[model samples]
Target chain A: MWDTIIINPFINLLLWIYMMVGNFGVAIILFTTLTRVILYPLTAKQIKGAQAMQELQKNKRYLDIQEKYKGDKEKLAQEQMKLYQELKINPLSSCLPTLLQFPIIIGLYQALIQSIASAPLDLLKLTRHLYPDFLKIPDLIPLNTQFLWMELGQPERLYIPGISFGIPILTIIVVITTYISSKVIAPPPQPGANDQGAMMTKMMNIYMPILMGWLSYTLSAGLALYFVVSNVIQILQYAITGKIYWGNVFPWLKKTEIKKP
Target chain B: MKNKILTIFIVISVLAISLTSCSDMNSTATSWGGATVTDSAVYFADGMQVIALRLDNGAEIWAYPEKAAANRTFLAAPVLVGEQLIIADAGNLLTSINSRDGVTQNWQFAGAKGKYIDSPLVVGETIVAQNADNSIYALDLKGTKLWAFTAEHSFWAQPASDGQLVFAPNFDHYLYAVNLETGVLRWKTELKASLVARPTLVDGVIYVGNLNGDFFAVDSERGTILWETKVAGGVWAAPIFVDGLLYFGDQTGIVNILDAADGSVVDSINVESGIVGSGVIVTDGIVFGKENGDIITIGFDGSNLGTKTVGGSIYSNLSINGNLFVVVATKGDNPLVAFDTDVKQSWVYTTSKK
Candidate 1:
């Protein structure tokens, strides 16, 4: 069922795109762009919602509720919901679209692994799930794996003599890009905001980059490329929507301002 | 609730990422493939699909999976035994396919631990295979287990034998000698490092190298290291002994020819790319593949005969029959490329072409 709904279609789409571009790296970029196009409306709406939420946090009533219920955790939660309802704000609007993109990311990761299959076995594994129509591409047995200086199918660690430092180039790029995107997309934590959800977001903001960096370091360069492209696109979407708060994304560069109530 | 679940997922993903040791993740497609060739056909384990192709023209006869198996992927070389092909996948399912037609399953067995990582070694009628978790199973032609061998670490290399006795290299830094008939440990010798390549039996001496780039020449009968020498890099492929001269490649892409008698380095030919696949000695000269997809052929004196780039990296062993020499470019656009003595591609078989 998953195969028909997600895996097979993704694998076939990737192969078809790969056939057109004759290179897996370009194919990945094109596929990422196509997905972004499909999800643009949802992504844009979410970005706008986040912007709204950031503005809402600056409201005097919201700040008063947060300060008044600072001691009662459950009361603070109820009051926050009550205030949001009074303001006609849907807090989930910003999250659903971000959640919607996860399956696509997982699906693309699987597709890229099989499409940029470096091993014959990996390629053979791909043959099992491919849509029958894709098999008709003529002389398309070996997809070109090279993209610039990287072998898209292999891990992207660079080796230099005598240095002994393992440099994962794509991993570093993925980390920086992911951090940049999170900064653009996430609503800035209010100065002295004592909230559970806000704390979790802060944790994600910090730890997520490290985790993503590790994945990009270990996984095939093809997947890393997809991640980099995905992050860049998300960043671009935020920039276009005018939702990016530079201070929030780059916290150290700007001092946190305590609002004058 | 949604936010809570999302936070949990983010935390789990971060944990998974931190635990990952920069190795191929469990989520990625597995990375094993090689082809074994006979006079009439070439068989490949493409991941989940096992394919049979005509050796002459790279035409496809049949492909397994006909549809995808949700939990299985064929990730290694399929051992061709007589009329049937005895193949095992990473799913712990050992299956036999009829080589003539490609779709018939004769029988199957499982190891109960994990999938087999190395190609099973075929003796007269016994098939011996090792798993990634360090268990070896010996089975008869009928898929019946005769005996099982266990070690401390994983065995990634195929077992080699001198008819009466078997030699297996383990990642636990030991080479074991087992009695093929009884399945008992005949003798065992610890090495300087983890031994991964199948031991090459020359005369009666067993030559093997480890991940530490330490190569050893062991006396097969007594199970003792006769001599050990350090090479340039890790030895991933099996060593090839041609006549009196010995040749093998390291992870650094340098092929070293050692004096088979004293384990002395006679000549070293650096291919400038990592050598992940073993070298094949053809009628023309000694030919091996580098991880960068170049097939390097050299003479006895280590002169650069020629180099040709096929595609991707080469990790599988080279299969040669007559003038048709084939190696599965297990990476990149995974294709089974056959070349003749003149270093020309005869035919290429991949999933798309067939």
Candidate 2:
């Protein structure tokens, strides 16, 4: 079922794009851009949802109700839901798109491994998954997986004489990009009754980089490349939508104020 | 409560990512060894055992790993020398089995430090075996070490011989021509990049391709690159010489017909997917395997014969035995498959997990 819906279609699309580009690295970049494009509307909706939350905070009725039921946490939650219903706002609307993207991400991860098959066994498995439409390309088989210095099929590691044994170069890129994107996507919390949410977000920001770094270090450079590209694109998309406030990110790096100012 | 749920979700995703990445690196998918087709049966390596099945029907004749003690998977293809079938795994272990009954003849372990990554070359009295490390060992028929040679990088390409000299292509971007008798280096030629394909010798010229997509026609006597041409992709499989014409495919699925006398392109054909170590077989005409599980057959004059799509990807080492062309699918519905000369399906055999 996974193959019929996601894996097969994803693999077929990846190879089809690769056939057009003639380079695996370029193919990955194109496919990632295409995915980002498809999910753009959902991303816009998420940003709009955030904007609506800020608008609701500014409303006098919402603030009065919050103060009126401040002592009773349960009543405060019930009133907030009532207000949300009046405004025709669904809090979970933003999350629906994100939930839908999980399968696509998993499918892309699987496709990256199969598409850049270095081993004969890997190639065999890939053939079984190829769609008939992909087979129509004349020079489609044996897709060249070499991109720049690294083989897209193999893990990207650089060997230095006196530095380290084998340093995963792409893995490092993935980690750095993940960190940067997290800062942009989920900035520091505003002063509100959301201390719990703030702490959880902070913990997640720290945990994700480490986890991504380990996975990137192990998987093929092709998938690592996908993560890096996708993260950069997500950050850019947030920035373009004006949802990301640059000042909120990396507050420690900000310049100290002068007395005259 | 929502925050706690989000925390759990994030934790699960992080754990899943770590687990999936680890699974990708250490893929438990059973890698299949290249097949050898005999008159009656087709033999191939699956997991730790080598199984032989009847060519006409998909009946299992015997398997080496039927016993618990003999259960060890191999990365290298099994080479049949005389009555002994030599199979080497990724580890430094070589198990010899009798071809007739699948009995364990001999097991040689700890002789080399690295695992065998390619086919064991049988050059005269010595069976030359190259490992994943930058080392090569020459063993006698009894699996005794005769001599060993080391290069600068890992030896990925299997060593080929012109009877007197053994040509070994190394990932260090050099091709060494060593004397087979003494295991002494006679000459070496540096190429555009590291070579991953087997070098073919016909008439005094050696034709080989490097990872950089450069195909070279080297003079066998002097070990000099006479002329170099370009292919579409990396040549992971060995090229076959048929009727003064060289037939080979690259990783990009481009199969080229090169002139044997001089390095010139005759014709080029592309398959549906990358050709991972698959080459052309001159049975009936030219039969080649593709990573997309398509067996593309082309006539001698570069005419399109026909293509047969199997349930699995076909390896480069497609073996021809009598009226049957046998190839194993590393992953798919059919683990072991045979096709007739007319490109018709003969039989398909599936394997049981260990």
Q: Rate the local accuracy (lDDT) of all candidates.
A: 0.76, 0.73
* Model 1: per-residue Cα lDDT at residue B158: 88
RMSD of each: 17.3, 8.3
What tens-digit string does per-residue lDDT give for candidate 1 at B1-354? Answer: 467757666755854543343234442245657777787787888766778888788888888757757577776778888898987776678888788877778888875465566688898988888775567788899998998889876666788988788899876678889888778999999886666677788789998887657889999999988988889876877888887777888876789999888889999888898776677777668889877777888886788888887787776678777778887775567477888867788988766885
Candidate 2 regions off by >4 Å? A1-261, B2-11, B14-24, B27-33, B47-49, B63-75, B91-93, B97-105, B110-115, B269-274, B278-283, B342-344, B352-354
Q: After superposition, how far is residue A228 of candidate 1 from its true place, in Å?
A: 27
lDDT of 2 by residue, A1-261 (tens): 888888787888888888888898999999999999988998888777766766666678887898899899999999999999999888777667776776787778877877765443454456567765545322444456678777676668887799868878889899888888876676445556356656665766777787778777766778788889999898999989866755446665434211214
- The residue-by-residue lDDT of candidate 1 on A79-127, one tens digit each, is 9899888888889888788777766766677677776544334544454
TM-score of structure candidate 1: 0.59
Q: Which stretches of candidate 1 lie above 4 Å from their native place?
A: A1-261, B1-30
